[model samples]
Target chain A: MKKIFFSFVMSFVAPMLFSQSYKPVQVNFKPMFGSQELVLNDSVYTFNLKDSVYIETLKFYISGIELLCKNKMVWKENNSYHLINLSEENTLHLMLQVPKNIHFEHIKFYLGIDSGMNTSGAQGGDLDPTKGMFWTWQSGYINFKLEGKSNACATRKHEFMLHLGGYLYPYNTIQTIVLPMPAKTSAIIVIDIKTFLSAIDLSKQHHIMSPGNNAFLLSQIVAKSFSPWIAPSKK
Target chain B: MDSTFQKISIIFFLLVLLTAFVWVEETAFKIPDNWPKPKYDFTKNPLSENKIELGRILFYDPILSKDSSISCSSCHLQYTAFTHMDHALSHGIGDSMGTRNAPALMNLAWHSNFMWDGAINHLDVQSLAPISHPDEMGENIVSVVYKLNRNKKYRHLFAASYHLSSITGEQVLKSISQFMLTLVSSHSKYDSVMRKQSLFTNQEKNGYALFQKNCSSCHTEPLFSNFQFVNNGLALDPDLRDYGRMKISGDAKDSLKFKIPSLRNIEFSSPYMHDGRFKTLNQVLNHYTKGIQKNNTLAKELETPIILSANEKVDLIAFLITLTDRQFLFNPAYGFPK
Candidate 1:
């Protein structure tokens, strides 16, 4: 009787204790500027806008992805704004999981932080300023971003950066994208750089560092391009 | 048998005492009467005296800096109206100069947003600006948190304030907000005059009227600011090329707009505007009367231009002095923690 009782306790307690450890996953993001999609190692595309433009850096934030199981919300990160530093190409990965109990039909989530969190004070994880996705002057998170110089542009290889962020009226630029993570035990979200830059018109507007019309429009276009991945059910 | 009943009663009383302790720890914040409702939603993080004190210490401590050289008090000195008067632009760690003037921090509970550009939406997270800015504290939140966690004093303070063994970023921000919220500046001479306890001189009364006509539209009453971003017709600096609210709002109509500052304690906070262009009250009045810029988004009230005479300008200056609050300036609670 004692041996049987001990077995029952171990069976229930063992799984509960071992199930909570987090396993990190890498998310591969790719960018395509202009018609020609720029490759990761391709001799940095020397594209000129007007003056001597040299693309120095591009950074932005991605937040609030919900893990789904069989079309039900399994779990979601409370605060999830990811800083994408293209300078370090391989530092992209979103850690998420589909619970064992439910069979996940797909995964769904927003691309940028919600309005509530943006107005709310500083947060931990990717939302933290150590990530460099926050603005120092007007205190809000930069939801989407693109920075670099264009030689063709009027401002000589002057560093042009667009720090896109604004959740309030007239300047709200928080873009939303829902990608389908198909029913799989393990999967990697491959983000191709070529796909993103193909739609964005860098020459017409090269520098947008704050929340405004340009930032909002560009963020919308980026969200639209994400459609190919977000709606993979048809693909 | 009587001993058994007595022991049961004692155990029940101990349980009740423990419940009462938890109840007090989780008590909600109550808005003080006769004060404007707070813009911040206190339901998120309830107030406690312990948390407010911890935030006060952190606000005054330079440990939030990369080199422990500057604290929030470095720019926001308690005296001189919580403003640094010597320099136009706020100079930070290693003698780095920030782009804009560090506005005086007070009555933050009523401010919908913070900074000259309305950049920071919430008070809890405002510290991140100075903390991470290369020209400011030059410290990252994670590193600062780690440093605070390592320090025995901060750890004890956090434990006392939050009833936790470790301090989290949320606790740190919330505690700081508590302290900043307590910085009430409603006891100024102007407030007293309004309350009918004190009287303003003829010069001050005339100045107040001129201010009402020329400045009160943007710099409203009581708090002395509408808290809205406006262009105020100040010409953009060629070197800085700041577009103010236009940069944040992205609206072409908002070009060159900036937040209208409070007139309270305006006498001491000279070199005003976002860039600290005006050196004196006379210069500021001169701009109002003759220096109105022809921006497309200029306020309609200032379209015709405010025509204040030399003597009227002096009266306006006198009224501004009434806003100087001696009590607030010397409040020991807002002084350095030491």
Candidate 2:
């Protein structure tokens, strides 16, 4: 059903804008709550009739971007690791260099860093251990970090810290995300955080700070929450 | 023999010798004569004199701590095999006592895991553990880099080592690793005895045989450790409540298991065990022989009872003393940079 919806929108949204045209790919990720852009800190949001939440931090890694045309890979970014930070507006957008005169029907990217970069010693730039994403206790990147306060949370100051990451076997939480592209040169991806928050009972499972079955399961749900931005008129 | 061929061969040999000299000068680290191939991959961050010097400075500098009150050398003193012998538990910033003993630092290039529980897999990334530990340095890597960048001497040192004005965690970690990989402790009298340059006394020889029969399975020869995690049947310290490997691995079977530390400089690296319960070598020997706290997760090597007479224990202690390398303890290069 989701594949049908993507193909249906594939025809209705974008009209083969490539036509062998050379252009740089621009991706802008939007973090959104239900029907509104997700604002950090100052804004109060009420959900589940009892939960009042405010996101203090939202950071995740987007890596291994690949553009596909007709279910075949056409372009892949090299050294493609980007840490999308809500606080840093510039970090949420990426400018990828695509091959000249190529058409891509869909866009695919990893929601977290892969096992290769995780095991390979200390890295520079976005993957640097100094970036606060890497785990000091263990050798792995914290693929996704969402820290905030919720009224439903019973802990001190009503805080919840979810640091999801694992590269080792049986607990590797890296997730692959694929979205249908609807533009020629630019794409706006929406990570509907509402879908994520609604899926889990944040009160009972608020603190998932390590790699385990909880992190692995939560990572999959978070991956499914990402989608290509659809026009309000079309929606 | 053709005179022309012989002349060409001599020239070629001289050229080879010159190349060897240049190559050796490029890298300061080398795998010892008969040691196992190092687990650390040097191709990623090759050794250099400037980087090692920078790393040594970082090792001794208190700038890495939150309040600049502690450095790595605080817990790991060079004279005592790079580990504090006085304290059983490592004390860090704010005089906070840590949960475990700070193990001796030596031959790090061959270590597969760092920390008592084998939490860190790579040596290059091992410094992150202590630098960020609240009880240890109480400083994050980002904050440390910020501190390093602000210091003029560190900036110059970093530039000299990496040829980059901007300091990153990778450079800091790789430089520290370069210095640690140079800590090769293979000059002990036991090593000399193995090389036939020296001979063990009759009592020492008897102790060696006993060590081989009883302890060598885990504390293997040459490196004096297989570097495998095993439960050495240490009874749980109720006050500390530390379960070594199980805390990291999250497996019931791994409970009470800890990495078999190398006995390279066992004489100076006293207050042994993960929690440093035993103060002297005699206490350790007593634990192995009579105090084995038989548990379901206990090491199989300890299943058999080890019986040592009073004289035999003395001989074993004598042999253990031969494992200490004064050169390593007193090496000026590894001491305060100045």
lDDT of each: 0.72, 0.89
Top candidate, metric lDDT: 2
Which pairs clash (backbone N, Cα, C closer than 3 Å) in model 2? Answer: none
The residue-by-residue lDDT of candidate 1 on A1-235, one tens digit each, is 3444577799998677547644433344554444344443334554333232334555666667666666677767655556766677654555554344544445565556678887777666667655667676577777766666554445655445666667777657776556565634544444443344445555557677666677777777767655223323553
**How far does residue A117 in candidate 2 sit from its true spot (Å)?**
2.1
- Candidate 1 chain A: 10-residue stretch with minimal lDDT: A46-55
Candidate 2 regions exceeding 4 Å error are A1-23, B1-25
**Mind giving the per-residue lDDT tens digits that candidate 1 earns over B113-194?**
8878776788887887788889999988778888989999999988887677887776777888888887878877788887
DockQ-derived CAPRI band for the predicted complex in model 1: acceptable
- Give the runs in model 1 whose Cα sits over 4 Å from its true position: A1-106, A124-133, A142-175, A178-235, B1-35, B309-311
Q: Name the 10 consecutive residues with the lowest summed lDDT in model 2 chain A.
A: A13-22
Say which docking band candidate 2 falls in: acceptable
* Model 1 chain B weakest lDDT span, ten residues long: B26-35
Rate residue A205 of model 1 by lDDT: 70
Model 2's TM-score against the true structure: 0.90
